[model samples]
Target: MIDSAVALPQGRRQRNKARVQERLFEAAVELIARHGYDNTSIDEIAARADVARGTFFNYYPRKDDLISEWSARRGTELRRSLVTEAGGLEPGDTVSRFHRCLAALVELNEDRQEVNRSMVTAAVRAGCLGARESATAELFTAILTDGQARGEIGEGLDPDRLGLLLRDAYLGVLTRWAVGAEQDHASLYRELHEVFKVFLIGALPRTAHRDCCPHTA
Candidate 1:
């Protein structure tokens, strides 16, 4: 007879492991948001999650690892949304598509403003914001490269440089909004749309055929 004690099923073990990881992640986010990153401890996270300290170690080697993983997940989601929303538009339509996507993103964030602010605050305190910045740069690079190849974006602008500038611009705007520096998201978005319109007009290929004229609404 097989020793049941010695032979734990793989599937059950995997499910339990996944559940533990999820709990730990949730706990980390909550604790960090409440106490700030530096003050949060692994033991506190484990206690809050109702998991043993060993389980926390098994899931994340360190508290910072948890923060990094969480930040990466959030960054991935944002990148996916940006790519999905912007992918279908032609190169010349990049400006309008971007404006629409930005507006949608702003709306989404407003609904989850507190959580978003908490995550941003935790990430900045942990120094993981730089990783997020790099991820944003890469996402914008993909967008710019595709736009350029399709003759949608202007020729003189380097994709890498343009990507960096665009990432910084969007991040700056979001930061301001997240910090409550701007109370009127609609007006902020309108101003940004106009700014992007002027910027794109100078950056997009002059010879590119425009199916739609850029308009600031």
Candidate 2:
């Protein structure tokens, strides 16, 4: 979902540039998502975007730039879902809110063997994963802080520190998925729900109902 409204460009020329840039980036991700990243070259990305091969360089100096952009967008997706509330914010169960946030995350990661592997390789090589992790961790901290206020989350928990750990746990499962170790669960969503159980053990108040976990999310 579009997280926010974008300001219109002042000039027609600037708008055209923005459109071309978006088209190129969208084309690149679609191509990489379909074919393996390594197998998809600059030529293919440019052709798919309907731009000249040289024009691709005009927007992205190197192919890795596109990957870095994609990684940033992935991080933004988390914030968009949680902070902005794609539809509209409605107060509810903190646990359920967090579950939905995580479910959105799970939906973002592809299960396709070649595509995910290639995307992981590109993300790692681009060196943007750490930034993504940090941004996502901050969002986690925000959620935990809110949950604590609502008396749903455990007290005495360090939201900032725990947020970083949550980020680690999130990536840990993602790493497993990336490595094709998600075979235990029938599907990726199920796999994440399984892993999230461990987090709830520490996150929820001791008095919180064990049945509060939403497995269907």
lDDT values, one for every candidate:
0.65, 0.72
> Candidate 1, residues 64-151: lDDT per residue as tens digits?
6775786567655666656555444333356665765566556655654555665556556665434435665665666677778878
Give the clash total for candidate 2: 0
Best by lDDT: 2
lDDT tens digits, residue span 1-217, model 2: 5322455434788778889999998788778777767778999989989999999999999888876676667777766766654543336577787788767786667534445556776665566445535667777787788888889788967888878777777766666666674465446677667666778775567778656766734
Model 1, residue pairs in steric clash = 91-152, 92-152, 154-204, 154-205
RMSD of each: 8.7, 6.9
Where is model 1 poorest over a 10-residue stretch in terms of lDDT?
84-93
The regions of model 2 sitting more than 4 angstroms off are 1-4, 85-90, 110-117, 181-186, 202-217
- How high a TM-score does candidate 1 get? 0.67
- lDDT, candidate 2, residue 145? 82
